[model samples]
Target: MLALASFISKHHPTLPITLISTADAASTPPSVTYRRLPDLAPPQPPIKNPVESFFETHRLHKPNLRAALVEISEKSRIAALVLDIFCNAAFHVSAALGIPTDFYVSNGSPGAAVFLNFPTMDETLDVDIGDMNDYLHFPGFPAIHSTPSKTVVFLCFGRRGLHSAEQLKETAVALERSGHRFLWSVRNPPGKGGDVPNLEEILPEGFLERTKEKGFVVRSWAPQSEVLSHEAVAGFVTHCGRSSVMEAVSSGVAMIAWPIDAKQKMNKVFLVEEMKAALPLDTGEGGLVTADELERRVRELMDATTGRAIRHRVAEMKASAAAAVGENGSSVLALHKFINDCCGRADG
Candidate 1:
């Protein structure tokens, strides 16, 4: 958003901008001045996945936002209102005020297409998502395969967070001897009892030392788009989070699905059974996978020949994704049409 805001300011300097966010969002990047609005204080007990939780929490600043919008519209004639797809409630306010609005799912277009196709997916495949063999022939343009070892693995949780401290220590240990290159996000290491712990103290002893050259541990919130686009990322080990899925597909990276909680498990099943774009790791219900399981799975994805083939197919999908946002890209056309209808013209 900062990037987009900066681009708009630089390329269209005359255009007035009013940035809005929760009070908590007020911080650096002081260049883009904003009108802080009333945003719900996040829940006292942090939800495991805040985004999902936020949607569940119906409390909104729309009334306050409406007043602000009305004020702004009165002065400058409000044009287009671009909103995140998950914020469905925004439509009500926009509709009430007769304001034009367009939804933006920053993830790739493929994810959006898949989300729309959910209702049409075969109901017979609704059972618990089985192993790679059970899903190797799943539906969709990109096919799946049963491979042995893999080269690169992309890791991120659907909820965007670290696993338990014990889980991380175990994973680090397993990766040390596996000899496979990994691109994992330990963005924030698990803290002790309640708060975030000092990362150095939490990491398994000598874990970083051993994997120093072969692995990359992102200690900060990652620029996922940039990382996925990097050539070294061959296959993504993901929780099938919509955003991650979109980013990976946009970059044409194969997947190894290891979904944890809500929506994710469902998304994984779809990708493996209906999308045929990924391999789902098996973990019996509520039985947390051991380090050995993670190691074996990672090795299979990185070194297997079939896994290499999956990577190739993913590359093709990546091209398709790029085209969707390119010159005549679906997203590009959509934006153009939106601008024409709301802002008056593309040139404007």
Candidate 2:
């Protein structure tokens, strides 16, 4: 979101952009108008036990968001409203105000975007998402085939403590056993006291020293876009978050799908089955992925011939992604149309 907003602010300074998020004043960028919203779905309190907390928070935001929209519209000549796909409640507000609303999926994958529009597409095609062997087809893209060694980047889990301590420990053990060079972004568990936990206490003893030469574990936060853009990084072990998936694709990196929550599982399906841009890890049994299995999968992705093919396909998609956002690109043309349609001019 920041990247897109920054680009617009830099290229079209006259156009105003307002960002409605739970981010605080310090975190919000100066390029955009930031409306402070209560973070009902905070990272603390471990939002795992009762999944309703997440939904309830979104429901709670409806009234406040509606008021904010109405207030903003009254202050300015609103052209159009762009919203995250999950912000369905806000759609009603836009409709009530007779304003046009555009849903931003934020993944930037044409294949994934098309998959989301499947309902509007021909309903005759029977694409079995459960079958990895089945070829899922989309318009404007070549047939996606399974490939075999792409360098792997592993993200332990999402921000909301979806994984248990045992699962995290198992992930650490797998990374060690894989013997592959990696960058792991590790975060403190939800509900933990103020201080960040020591790496020794969290990971296996001697784990850091053993992998010091090849692996880097970043506690709290890591510059994900920078890390993924590195030439050495070829694939991602991710939770299938939209932004992360788009970043991986834009950087020509393949994936090992390990979706943890929400629409992530659906995104994983798009990457693994629809787009064939990823390999899926099985966590259905016991919910604990053994070190041996992790090592095998890592080796297959990093050292196998099939991994090379996957990397090649991902490179092609990277070119497509770049072209889509380039001058006179599909996304560029769409933006122009949207501006002209909403504001009655392309200058806005």
Candidate 3:
């Protein structure tokens, strides 16, 4: 939200802008004053319960957040609390203080779709989430086509401590040998030659160079929004993080969910079976996929008939997302409402 904060500051300089972050982020930019809070660390192997996870993260930082709130509430005439929906404690804090609050789903439409319970692909034991079977069968959405078969695609792992290097390599090799074109965003950490082997060295020999044309391998942080918006990007292999989900839906991209941490699994369920815009991958025992299986699925998804249908549906979804945020759009109206409600006037 730093980008949003910056935009707001530039557009409305008279508004007092104090950003609350962790102590590590105390050296924030000049336009915004930084109030340091505590940091949060997640559990190893990660937990599946979203409620439990939320409390744990907040517990680490709540004391500092409360202190910041106390100071702000006492000194300034606070207007409104605009918060990310995932930031669970913000709502309660604002309510306790009787401040008007607006929840912002930073991840956008796809993220919002999950929250709203859009229809999704069906799941059976052993088999991963298949391609879109129908037009998601949701209200306000037109009937779109679904693919028959899909690849056993696994997306990028977020900072949720989900997939290990061993697992990533294992999957990559399987896909490569299977003749399946895998599109992956493999970000290499800073510095070379260390305790952990880099992704470049971990894959099978000639794995990347051979599949250079077929597979899309982005080495650094990709312009995810743009990539998802591309025609070639038929299925999204995502960590099922809110931001990624939003980008995919906003761009009309389908998904292959492999939620790592946070409320990702919840998001996975919402998308795969609920939203119908994506399929789910198994976080099964061994967490390994064979090359033959990977190839069969990837070919199934990329086939002419399957790819074409998904493309059309995604195109429609793209329009809906655009409309949602367009001028006088739903999200725009919501923003206006929030502004008016908070400031008591549009001009403010």
Task: Pick the TM-score winner.
Answer: 2
**Ranked candidates, highest lDDT first:** 2, 1, 3
Stretches off by above 4 angstroms in model 2 are 1-158, 345-348
**Which predicted model would earn the best lDDT?**
2
What does candidate 1's lDDT look like per residue over 1-348, in tens digits?
455667777877777666655555554243556776765566345568988678754336677768878988888887777666676676788889999987777666755655555565455233233223222333342432334433456676633555776777767766776787887676444454533444566678777777878887765445777878876667777877889899888877788887866788899888888767787676644545667777777776665344555655576677788898999999899998887788765456
lDDT of 3 by residue, 159-247 (tens): 43334555656667656765654667665433434434455676666777887865766554556677666654566778788888888
TM-score of 1: 0.49
Any idea how many clashes model 1 has? 10
TM-score of 3: 0.48
Instruction: Estimate the TM-score for candidate 2.
Output: 0.54
- TM-scores, in order shown? 0.49, 0.54, 0.48
CA lDDT for candidate 3: 0.62
Off by over 4 Å in 3: 1-155, 159-162, 178-182, 187-197, 286-297, 306-312, 345-348
Residue-wise C-alpha lDDT for candidate 2, range 186-300, written one tens digit per residue: 7655455543556787788899999998788877566778878877676688888889888989988878888777699899899988887888887747666666666666766
Report lDDT (CA) for all predictions.
0.68, 0.71, 0.62
